[model samples]
Target: MLYDLFLKPYEGYSTLFIVLEAIAAFFGIVSVWFARRNSIWVYPTGIISTVLYVYVLFVSGVYGDAVINIYYTAMSLYGWYVWLNVKGEGQALPITWLHRRSALFTGGFTLANFALFYIILQYYTDSIVPTLDAITTALAFSAMYLMARKKVESWAFWIACDVISVGLYIYKGLGVTALQYLIFLILAISAHFEWVRLYREQQAAQAHPGNTTTKPA
Candidate 1:
């Protein structure tokens, strides 16, 4: 009943939809796991997920979602470089804490993205769900920026976005999309704890001497 009811219009598109969702889910989970391990491959996997979702979301009339995916693609590339080249003086970029400046910039970017999405959705798409679209758009942008900077709070934001996104996908009758978001929710929780552990270990390494010199490797 559910699949049939939700999938009536997209029956012809089923194969394509399922394929994209499967690829997105695979890459999204891998990306999150890589991020928790502080690995550089996270960005490339993330780009794969977002780029496919951009095409998927656009066909679903989710203009804001498509736009967010575009930004995510760009963020993935930028994050790839930042994760590789960004290093502090003596410590290397050891999951640096979010500074006051970054917080302010992220907040400002979220607000601007929200406004821009709202206007686009309202004027361009006949979507009554524009408000929800804008909210998720802003949340995703902030979360990506936080993730690029290796902020611990990025996981929490992603968890929230996944939860809401699950509902949105279900409502939009995208069964595969809903399933992907559910998987994302679980990974987001994992990321939160993993990063917290890394942060604690990082702090400990700073406080102690020879014993603290050991790395996560």
Candidate 2:
């Protein structure tokens, strides 16, 4: 039963393609794991996964996902630089909560991305799940942007994106990718809480400088 549900789907695909997907999935998991730990390695690992997925997802006819992976590649480069740069003296970029204004901007940006992706996928491409693709892609785009800035809300966007993508990939016959999203969902949720705790710790240190020791995020 499990074989029929899982391995059977990929029986028609080439071994090379299957191996590529698995490798992409592995790097994707590593990238997110690094992100959860607030490590700088996330960007390089993520760039590798995203570049691989850009090809894999494109061949799989998941055009929205392919496009987002392309965006992720560029964003990873930008994020890497942003994460490395210091503020005031030489302190690394700290984890921060999205303020009200930034939250509003993110919402607007996500909506715009949704509209653009929907239009292109629906009319321009022969995409099967245009709406779902657009939804997940838009959410992921914003999530990537926020994550580049080390914002706590990035995990929230990732959580929503992963939840929707789990069903989307399953419906699209990408079982392995669906499983990846399921893992991503779990990690995103855990990362959210961990980041919140880190943010609070930073706040506490700032409030009581003499009593609390500051840690790099």
Candidate 3:
């Protein structure tokens, strides 16, 4: 069972897929690490991972995932620019919480995308596990958008999506990808707390204008 879940990909799946997925997963880890640190490298690393996943998922016939990867790539580019320009005290984009109105919009948009993708995958294609695929893809869309905007709530969406995706990838027989999501789940949880701390520090700094020691950015 251990071998099947971990090592079997090299034998059961195509060598190309194993290699590509591994590469994508590696950079994905890196991207998340950079994101946790609020580093600018996150977008570049994320772009590479998403672009590779687009090809990987498309060839594997997970069209919903492929489409999301494409969306991720575009968002990564936009995020790169956004992060570059939005300067705080030290030229870093300030971390922020989502506004109430933005939160409602995000919720609605996520549900709408889930429904749209579910219908498309169910009717237009012979996609296996279309409902789960649509769900994970939609959550991912929301998470990516929030992250691009540097919202602290993005980690919550990521944590939820990563947990669901662990089961989804396992069900699809992509064991390595399942493992990646498990790691992502852990990272997202940690990132949530870390970002919350950062947000609080930023808030404190804003309240105390003379405190030069706490640079939340």
Candidate 4:
């Protein structure tokens, strides 16, 4: 099916795919953009995007992605509550870095997801686009997990994932999705630097009186 997309170009199919992709991508960008500014609206926008993609990916025969969106929806709901109402030590934590052990666990889990995806794609699904989809899916899972945890390094993972997603979308003849991923690639880079700068100024603020300032806005 994927080969046929390029081997025998289907204009109608491409057009319909582009429409759905655009809707999903738009909300995704909005959510991630809000997230960079430490805004709480990210989860709401993410919910919409995930809901849309669940149907979209399922129709496209990317079952893993479809399933993942279900998880994304659930996680978004959980994160929403956690962000708004949860407090630690009588204060809501703004943002925090992952501990060393947590980082190690994340890396290990990502690797495990990749291995599982590879095995499932290579053997179970007969999807011609399985390998590519699986790779992106695994990366997305890692990136989403980091984001949910409020880790600064999530942007790094997003940069890597979105860059690869661009190539994958373009290869799959999803031109609009490719463009969305391209835009996301740039945003992810910006968010990474933005978060790092924010983290630095935060640390400095703790040391000094009121001199250090880092505004993600």
For residues 4-84, write the lDDT of model 1, one tens digit per residue.
635664676878686886798788778777877877778888899999988888878877888889999999888777766
- Output the number of the lDDT-best candidate: 2
Predictions in order: lDDT:
0.80, 0.90, 0.85, 0.75
Better structure of 3 and 4 per TM-score: 3
Q: Which is the winner by lDDT between candidate 3 and candidate 4? A: 3
Candidate 4: residue pairs that collide: none
Comparing candidate 1 with candidate 2, which one achieves the higher lDDT? 2
Query: For candidate 3, lDDT tens digit of each residue in 1-217?
Result: 8787677645756878888999998998889888887777888999989998998888777889889999999999988888877445554567899889999999999999999999999999888889988998899999999998889999998998898889987767777778888988988899999989977887898798775422222
lDDT of 4: 0.75
RMSD of each: 2.8, 1.8, 2.2, 4.1
Per-residue accuracy of model 2 over 80-190 as CA lDDT, tens digit each: 999888765546788998899999999999999999999999999999999999999999999999999999999999999999999998888888899999999999999
* Residue 176 accuracy (lDDT) in model 3: 76
lDDT (Cα, tens digit) per residue for candidate 4, span 1-217: 6555443434555666656767898998898888877777889998998998888767666676776788789888877777666453333334568899998998888888878887887788865677776777777788887777678878877888787778876766655556777888888888888878777767777788655333223
Residue pairs clashing in model 1 are: none
Clashes of each: 0, 0, 0, 0
The weakest ten consecutive residues by lDDT in model 4 span 86-95
TM-score of 4: 0.83
Residue pairs in candidate 2 whose N, alpha carbon or C atoms collide under 3 angstroms: none
Candidate that scores best on TM-score? 2
- Model 2 lDDT at residue 124: 99
Compared with the true structure, model 3 gives a TM-score of 0.92
- Rank all candidate structures by their TM-score, best first, as comma-separated numbers: 2, 3, 1, 4
